[model samples]
Target: MIDLNNEKLELNYPCKWIYKIIGKNNQDIKKAVKEILDQREYVLKLSKSSKKGKFKSFTLELLVHNEDDRKMLYDILYNHDNINMVL
Candidate 1:
């Protein structure tokens, strides 16, 4: 028998990290995620973007493997000229 309440949840174990990516271009998000989180086990959650005449707003949620991976991704996207920002 197992008791759920008796178990303690520790964050020591490696878990996926989520990053909310914001940009003015959809292609930028795709490229950034690919260049950053691609080839690694991750899930990308994209928000519906509004169609503004000359402006665009988009968001992407990326699931990273660990802290190191998240840092690597941040550096990649942050340094990229096409990427607006990553949170």
Candidate 2:
């Protein structure tokens, strides 16, 4: 078995990356993403919501030029006020 913690996963540069964002409001999440990614092309799709509808989730896909770009996007989303969780 491979030890994921000790191994690095190879990723091609300028590839598509997907982020799963969960938040209290879908519109708020979209707005936050738009504000951060302004002018960049991306795809956003509604993934799901809580049973009582208190929370929502979305799948955001975009092109990442390299590791820094991909990780930077994750940091931005993870630090956004409107976003509760990121994966």
Candidate 3:
């Protein structure tokens, strides 16, 4: 089996990146993304929700200019109050 802990992802710059964001409310997630990615073109889709209806998830796809830009977006989403997880 591959060592998941030591695995590293190599991504090319200026490529399409997808962020899976989970939260308690879908609207809150959308608002947060909108505020962070203001004026930037992106695609957002409702992924799924917890069976108990307590959490929701969304998939955001966009073109990242570079590694820093991809990481920056991850940080922004992770810092959002409504967001519970990012993957």
Candidate 4:
């Protein structure tokens, strides 16, 4: 089996990246994403929700110019209070 823990993703710059964000409120998550992205071209889609309707998942798709930009976006979204997690 592949060791997922040790496997580092190899990706080319200026490619599409997806951020899977999960949180308690859909609107809150949407607002957070909007604020962070701030007029940048991107696609946001509602993926699914938890069984009890307690959590929501959204996928944010956008083109990242470089490793720093990609990682910066991830950090921005991950640090937001309205966002519970980002993957």
Candidate 5:
């Protein structure tokens, strides 16, 4: 059996996770990443270093509320016109 009080306790704080965002261009990458961070109610920990190549990438660690919140974040990123890919 589960305790109602315990279940309520779990909902008190936001959950955190790391997301790696890969895109086609540097400007678009930064713009997309910033949009996600700014538009959502999340705390972001952006990667300081990224490998340089044909594609631009940034690793972002986010402290979100739950799985749904994460999915929303992904949806926003994926929908951005400047963003070609996200991982």
Candidate 6:
């Protein structure tokens, strides 16, 4: 039996990474991402929003140089005050 908890995902370096950034407002999230990325090349698209328009999600796609680079980006987005979640 494979121990899923002990397993890791194998991914090639310099690959495309996608992050779903969620926030209260799409405009605010867009501004926050611009500030956080700061000229870094990335593709941001409006993915979805809550039925009542309380929450919004954006898809952030970018090329990550390596595993560390990918994780670092995730950490940064997850820690930002403007971002509620990063997945």
- Cα-based TM-score, every candidate: 0.60, 0.92, 0.88, 0.89, 0.62, 0.88
Task: Indicate the worst ten consecutive residues by lDDT in candidate 6.
Answer: 1-10
lDDT of 5 at 38: 74
Tens-place lDDT digits, model 3, residues 1-87: 767888788777899999999999888989998999998999999999999999999999999999999988999889989889999
Question: Each candidate: what lDDT?
Answer: 0.63, 0.94, 0.92, 0.94, 0.66, 0.91
The residue ranges of model 6 lying beyond 4 angstroms of the native Cα positions read: 1-6
User: Per-prediction count of colliding residue pairs?
Assistant: 0, 0, 0, 0, 0, 0
* Model 4 lDDT per residue over 1-87, tens place: 767998788998899999999999989998999999997999999999999999999999999999999999999999999999999
Model 2 lDDT tens row, 15-54: 9999999999988999999999998999999999999999
Clash pairs, model 3 backbone: none
RMSD vs true structure, all candidates: 6.8, 1.2, 1.9, 1.8, 6.8, 1.7
What lDDT would candidate 2 get against the real structure? 0.94
Those runs of model 5 whose alpha carbons end farther than 4 Å from true positions after fitting are 1-13, 39-52
What are the runs in model 1 whose C-alpha is more than 4 Å off? 1-10, 48-66
Per-residue lDDT of 1-87 in model 1, one digit per residue for the tens?
Answer: 777997875554255556666666766667767776556665666655557533344444445556676677778877787766667
Q: Which stretches of candidate 4 lie over 4 Å from their true place?
A: 1-8
Clash list (residue pairs), candidate 1: none
Rank by lDDT (best first): 4, 2, 3, 6, 5, 1
lDDT of 6 by residue, 1-87 (tens): 767997888999899999999999877898888988896899999999999988899999999999999989899899988899999
